[model samples]
Target: MIRIFKQLLMTTLSIGLLASIVGAQGQQTVEAASDSTQATIRVDKVDNLSSDFIMGADTSTMISEENSGVKYYDFDGKQSDLLTILNNNGVNYVRVRVWNNPYNEKGQGYGAGNADLINAIKIGQRATKLGMKVLIDFHYSDFWVDPGRQVPPKAWQNDTVDQKAQAIYDFTSNSLKTLRDAGVDVGMVQVGNETTTSGICGVTGNDEYKLFAKGTQAVRDVDKNILIALHFTNPDKTTTMLNYAKGMAKNKIDYDVFATSYYPYWHGSLDNLTYVLKTIANTYDKKVMVAETSYPYTLDDTDGETNVVKTTDDIKPAGYPATAQGQAHALRDVINAVANVGPKALGVFYWEPAWTTVGGTDRAANLPIWEKYGSGWASSAVIGYDPTVTTSTYGGSQWDNQALFDAKGHALQSLHTFKAVYTGVNEQLPDPMLSDDEATIASLLKNPSFEETKMSDYQLTGSIKLAQDTPKTGKNALNFYGDTDYSADASQTITLDAGTYTFSPSIQGGDTNASSDLAIYATINGQTKSVKVAPLTGWKKWLKPELTFSIAKQASVKLGIKIKSNAKSWGTTDDWILTKIANSDTDQSGSSSSQASKTSEQSASSESDTLASSMVSTKSTKNDVSSSKRDKTLPRTGEKVMIGFGLVGIVMLASVCVIYFKHQAS
Candidate 1:
């Protein structure tokens, strides 16, 4: 009875201590959650003068949005002129992208503002009238050009490198002359839009430098006073993009400002951004700036078009919430980072803050207007210009949620982010969102998260396996990589009752180009719908992509991932989920909210199960006295705590046995 009482007392003490530790840990988590809202402007105007900092916005689609019947409003909620509102909020520079041609032979518009020289001049005139300097971004293509696609203008498709260079010079000189003739104050000219991947004017390699030089020459000849800028994207791959500048410097390419696109989520750390820009400024003796950057203020889809940022899981990737203040925090930090780069830094520009919905808020109502006004992402009219744009999968803005204005055009609080940073606008923002990774929903696919030791439920083909190198979550992820040209595919077929569902998976790493085609697809009833995963700049960069589909009746659906790449290309996909959302016609497990609760419970249960398993294993090892039984590598607290308790219990047992034996001997 005495020994049993002593044993029970020790056990109770151990339990109390462990419970205290756990409670303390839980309290700390809650405190951290609440403190996330205490965000302040980490860097102040100490980096540069307010007057010198260039607060700019890329209002490329403003004209199209306005023409589509968007009304502007001031902070006071009074309807006001857009330019006046921008100027009032301290925006001193405007950027407008100009394409060589955005229409077919029939003169039908290709959308994205139809920003030819005429519309660009008109937009520039508005900003210029408001005393704001303009940065003319020449895409040098007939349509939108980026790392993904850089098609040459139709008129220059047959031109050689030399011919294209001459065409560039002539086109630029004429465009600048026209802008000057229109009384627009042009402060800078971006020679190419995101030319980091390849060449301009449909050329690649060394020829790209030659074409860029001609564009720079044209800018100089037209107006030496105007700052000439070369723009690139993906500062995360600092080595690669820095090499672009080094290549230009090696080739004697004359340019003033070296600009980069900085999306907080897509790009790497801001410290890296500062380091790269600082190196370029000091090494090449050129000014640096963020040519384009923007963050979503909300995840709510204001327009009928799906938002670029669709999930709440995406909002805090950069450590900011999807609130108005969160947008401000992101923008301010980008400015602070640029300013932190020292005086050689020019400024930062918010991209397309005003590209809201056209016509009315409804998607159906906006379609005809988008078609009529060329206000959507890509109109059916662009099918003639861009072969990639199909009659379907076109129209509606993917950027409405990222706009600095709400869908109704009222300026978001983030609009003042520019002025606030310049004037040392230091204020506390709401804490960042608290997220639950253990979140899960009912799904048919086993080992859906790739958490299982083996690829049990998933069907694999060609170099497909679970990888430990890098995962978005957990210790393992589904990886696709190869040294030679290859097509790798992985799939899981599940039978489901009649229902509509959305499949979301996070994809990371790749060549940042589309030639290989990395995608997640779902096939139901002999019909397949696939969403292309963009090849990001680096492995560390991640994107949450979703694909939605519905079945009229119960059927089998094959959900999978496919990757086609040339030599030495790679990417990863993880955290698979297929959940039934609300629809007018459907049979689902439960409402989205109920499923969310269940998923939360499942996540928590999984965590609890792991904890319980560890504890049981620890308890089972109390009598494990063999030398090999002890694992010297103790990484978790429970095991260490249990070991300490075991030692104490053993010491007490030895004392009791010694006393009892001594009494018997006496």
Candidate 2:
């Protein structure tokens, strides 16, 4: 049942994304370019950019990409070095975001360009050779950092605030010295990336600004001429942005430039973007610039990893179409927006624009590459540092379609926007009519079917993964279990209004002879309810058992599949759903609907025992399974298991046993 609401609450955005493997997948996704010529997106230049206006692109991952054998081509399709291509397109600055350590204790690179000091050195050296300046963005964390997170490096986890400030100064000073030694033109240094809410080192508000002051002091000591920049994002919140700007002054955080990340998608309108920056510039007498901005040329997944902007609705926030020309217009307009803020506007940096497609349209084929080559946004190795790296959010780039280069590694028309902003693109371009899938559903839960195989929404445990052995319907199913006795589940939490809902989980795997138990469980408030599935007799066979429950008010509910199995017990589960069938103001125990739901659950359990017993009897007749009582079993999602031969064996003489013996053929 497809339930279309005003919006999808269950899936996407940073939340919408942690899950999605469908709506955009395999094959050439965007429509072929049109033969008829159309006018290229033109920009209304305002002072355009003086010789000092920064045209920057975050090519932080280009090293890993080039190492992976990707080649960069100019707009004309001629092979060229990346820096040279950018230079030809009027790009004068290269922004490189560096992490303290994006690796695990095993020393494996945690992908996402493995943004270590070494890569920064390599990129700085290369970009400087072409006369382009480098902006060294220090995230001050082992992994990615933004407004939501500010984990201090492990080495300084236990340090005091004063100690952290000193450590920040020393680290920044040493890193700048290293870059200078490498014959690189280090033009600017960013204290932190998007340090608005929680700035750095697990600190909040004023504490965050203090850390930035230490970093700024180090930059000033290293090179007075080098711009000391403080970066923040979200200009949409005028009051917040203004107060943050004022907070910088109140805290006396000395910095030369104030940078904001202005992605047209999530960040607010261009006018607001200008107003926020202009206020800071005029008030503080500090230079301002856009630290990051990007727009997708298409809503397709070029590398099988889901694209962040995978739907038409995504660009609606920015009012831009998903096309190469549309991408150019968005970028060009941003450049003009910053330039219009007077000469104090330093420039705009297109964040990771060159992070093009590195893998094919199959995540299975791409996951290993992501783990090894530092390609994906995050890797399994980073799970050590960032607890958020799950089976779904760990691998592959969600920003590929938004890259300046096409999936084929050729520069898109958007790349020329840097130069075209001032000179104006005179050529008539192709329409390149492109469209995306419903991409996102307004479902109560945010997730995908196995055919998508991305496993976008669920947090899986143990041996569970989307297996392609034999799908329940499409190309894959949720599979779990191994030779050893283990408990596994794929769970996702959802928020819903108070009402009665039915949860039905489809399952398959093994035969009636299997000793494993596959059940669907839902956790509402503090209580958990579950229903076991019937025995599956065929590899393609699937059984769904319904469990209904009620909540009195708006509450968070956790839903997922639970497996408790003996040794060598394995199973596949798929298409689990929770549907709200009614709305009543009655209590769960008093409502008729609740009673019916409980009765349905009991009926389903009775059927499971009857069918599972018959399958077991057939297997016993063939001498395929042992008659002795199995040892361990996982009953609920997090319930303790019975290891030894508990009283459960003696309790097996129920109707299930009676049915089993009657069906037995001696």
Candidate 3:
């Protein structure tokens, strides 16, 4: 009977232990869910603003060419419509260009897309069905219209300025009416294509404004809400673009947006593009956009066509290679640049991203077509129709390498870059929590120190640990030991405006078996610059290392520490700081101070100095080491606390087993 009683007691104790464990687990689950809900709320407040921004692409040649045997494939090689692919990838806008007449008297097609009114209408209608916004780009010519060749159609060449203006109005109004009649929703329209220096229909100077005004008036007459865009090329010519805008204003051109063709290879630097966009947005109070842009995914020729964008000169703007990833990076940077201009900067449209190498014969086979129907006076000037000796060909697209679709018609990774939108609201938007100055001094880094056990915004490797011992200031420091050669310790990526910045960190070297060094490295625009900290003499003292460098443009930079290879190398780092240097300062480390001075300044600040006193109190209470009060460490203290609780639970379970066994013996 006693044995049975003891067995019952033991079973009861076991059930009780299991219940306690389950109860603890349920409590943890509830807390985790609560924390996740709070985090989601914070994220939605920032992400919801992106809904107002547009991400668009230009597939002018997609419909006609796709019907003529060209096809587009997804990453998995499944055939997909160009618009479907773009829309699926987060592109909300599709731009289709329209030409007046692209066929000869004999009806011989003008091989390059033959982007006539009907073709454009078909494309726009399809885009609308997909629920994507349509942007109709009116070329105002019989063929392609660009900065170099803005020739008027043969029918309109002989017309007077007033007559030509009427013709433009009639054509634009009629075409827009046709699209709208077909149930197409046109959100935006470009009046002219790339009228950088001269205007179309043989117009020049202020007369160009008359042409623009006529087209814009026609657009407004059709639908007053339709946004009219005045297009230009070469954003580096700031003075020229400004003058053009001024002339349009003088002529009272009723345009809603200013658009630019910003091909980095031809138009100049991304910096120049940013400056021009910002200037236009601030000066004109009009929406600005990069109407046309493209980067090469590969420099190698896929067909007989000679690739135009080959060489370092072409790909240097974003310093990305001519690979799939590089193309994505370049496109992302361009979009980000436009987003940086605030809400007035609409978005970007990648030019001919779906023009893959297909359909037409080789250069030799297409020579006769070029000579007979394409070598007319107008065709001879346009490169698309030029019948040269036969080396290069337009039969296969010269821009196939730059297309978002690969040679096999598969959509490249670069297509996905268009989906991201800038979510930052305008500074004028009221925020109760932030003062004007406080908002201006936003910290670029999320976690600048290793005080917390968890590291956010940083990628870490090679035996990284948050050590409580030997911290320079905070309660903890980032400890790294690289027994192997050239290992990355920790890195954080930061995006900054065009300026100089100083990266400073306090480091202490642990005992080393051989000569070793800790190096601070900064990578910007595909270039890496590194500086070595002092070698370890002893663990008693900490050394502060600082490196300053200038970024020629607004760019994303990777800053990190690396341990050089040796027999044995280890180090501890704390109190990391990154500060932008004043524009007037030439020295990279001009804003940095010695460790002793930093300590003295902290000590000298009185309690009445709210800002300084608050900063100190935060460092002590929150265990944050960043110099900026706005920077907060991610909470990782729970990791250690959870571990402690786990150990305690294990001991308690063992004690219950001992007590039950002792009762059984009695």
Candidate 4:
């Protein structure tokens, strides 16, 4: 009884200790020391300053009272539409994309999307009227810049790479000049749209630094103060993009900022988006933004022509309530995520926030304006239309009501929430620690070059198997958490953002029959290191076992984990577990980059799985004895102690029950 009571006391102490540890992990807000002499800015001044800095919206659907109920103007008639509202609210800038001519040869107008000097002037006029800065987006081509297409303007159709370069220069210079003359205050300009395709007429854009330099330089020449941005589609493709940017920089292409389009439905998830932004920002010393991002309010809408699509394979199901209210929540979530990125995260620009309604002629295929002119010129309308009138496939409007303001122009409640909440750039969050192995694996998984990956923040629980003869070749071959694992022994690689991390395993040894030895390893920059573990013996309760290590912030490195067994002379790994935790690389570490050295000649032992029982084998020996026997003998001091206390209480209750029974019988 004494021994049992002692055991109970120890178990209670252990649990209490764990609870204390967890409590210590929480962050505490500290009060600043009082300093009455410090200069204090007026509240009004701070409000004005904040309004001038925060700009996060897309007004493609922005309309004036003269055209439709949806007006960029506010309730106060004194203020002009969007610009004034932006100036008053925290929107200091706006981005406007321009397309070449957007007109048919017949001289008919192609509408607002046209980069014609006339429309540019009009848009510029509106911007100036609102006292907002404008960003001109030159698609270069007469149409859109997309992954599947990059149609050069008619003028440059037959031009050589050199001619194309000149055309780009001439186009940029002329466009900027026209906007400048119109009294528009230019803030930034995008040289091109998402360009990840092959070159124009055989000139490769993937690494065509010379061509990129020419185009960017042309824009820079127009106005040195205007921030020049290089845009791409995916954030995770940092290395590929960095290589291209480095090439451009090498050739003297000067641009002010770096940007990428990170639509999660098209990219992956917020985590992936964060990984991409943090990595790129840390790699290149440039401010960045999530140039375009959006989430669907519902999956019910058919993805006929809208940017949001309904696909079964999204990382997560529609996040909103699948209703307008849900969409607001989703949008809020996205905004918060972007805000969480902090200062390095300049801000977010919700793509086409005003693309609420589809217009009548927007998607008329084979029409001169859309097919021949390549501008969707005849189509592209921001208002809803009678579906009965469409004789063609792309005639309905899908974006009419998704605006911050309703179709009737009343601002949504979320707008006020947004206006009040978004104070400044989100401060970068601290990095969590990771074990050396976890860091290496995360780094390898994040690198886009490694190919297939599925490392989502999604919680997963399951058993995995690797081949004995060739451990990585089995049915459930272990893979990098980020990449897909196909066969046994197949290696995967990934590049990670800078941070400290903790690597941990989910699968315990008790569940597997084979005596496996799991090895975790990391190679930062280039240096390689390894950590070893013994296999589990059987079914076990979950525990938070972690490995902590520090890695350079934003360092590009390779990480890996392999499993093997000792008895079979043939390795067999039935279940494997691995993960990472990252430390805040910045603030804690200096800016200098580091190099890694590979370990000296070390031959891996042969694969073997001698134990045949489905039960966990004896490999996890704590040196004193095998884990299985020890587990049974010790009763896991903690678990035993609890059991003892529980039994004592149960016995006491039973004695009470007996006394009651005897009294009743008497």
Please report the candidate that would top TM-score against the real structure: 1
lDDT of 3 by residue, 241-331 (tens): 7766777777788998999987755455566677888888888888999998888876665655556665432343334456554566567
Residue 154 in model 3: shift from native, Å? 1.1
lDDT of each: 0.74, 0.72, 0.66, 0.45
Which ranges of candidate 1 are over 4 A from the true structure?
A: 1-50, 425-666
- Lowest-sum lDDT 10-residue window in model 1: 625-634
TM-score for each predicted model, relative to the true structure: 0.64, 0.61, 0.54, 0.50
Q: What lDDT does candidate 4 reach at residue 169? A: 79
- Which model is ahead, 1 or 4, in terms of TM-score? 1
Q: Report residue 5 deviation for candidate 1 (angstroms).
A: 63
In model 3, what are the clashing residue pairs, if there are any?
A: none
- lDDT string, candidate 1, 442-524, tens digits: 55577776767677678899856665434555445677655357788999998877766777776666653446777789988
User: Residue 366: error of model 3 in Å?
Assistant: 7.6
| TM-score of decoy 1 | 0.64
lDDT per residue as tens, model 4, 1-666:
657755665565555554444333321101110121111111101122223333556543243212322344343333245545554555556777776665556654333244455555676678777777777777776544554456676667788878877777787888888888879887888777775543332256434555577778877778778888777764544345566556556666677666777654334345555666566566666666767665543333221343224322221222222223334444544555555554565665666544433223234332333322222212433112212213343322244334454444433433433454443221131111111111122332332112223534222222222211111211122221111122122233445565654443333323223454466556676676666644443322222223344665666544445545332122223223333433464543442122111111111222233335211321221221223223212112243444455455555555555654665576
Q: How accurate is candidate 1 locally (lDDT)?
A: 0.74
Q: What is the lDDT of residue 281 in candidate 1?
A: 96
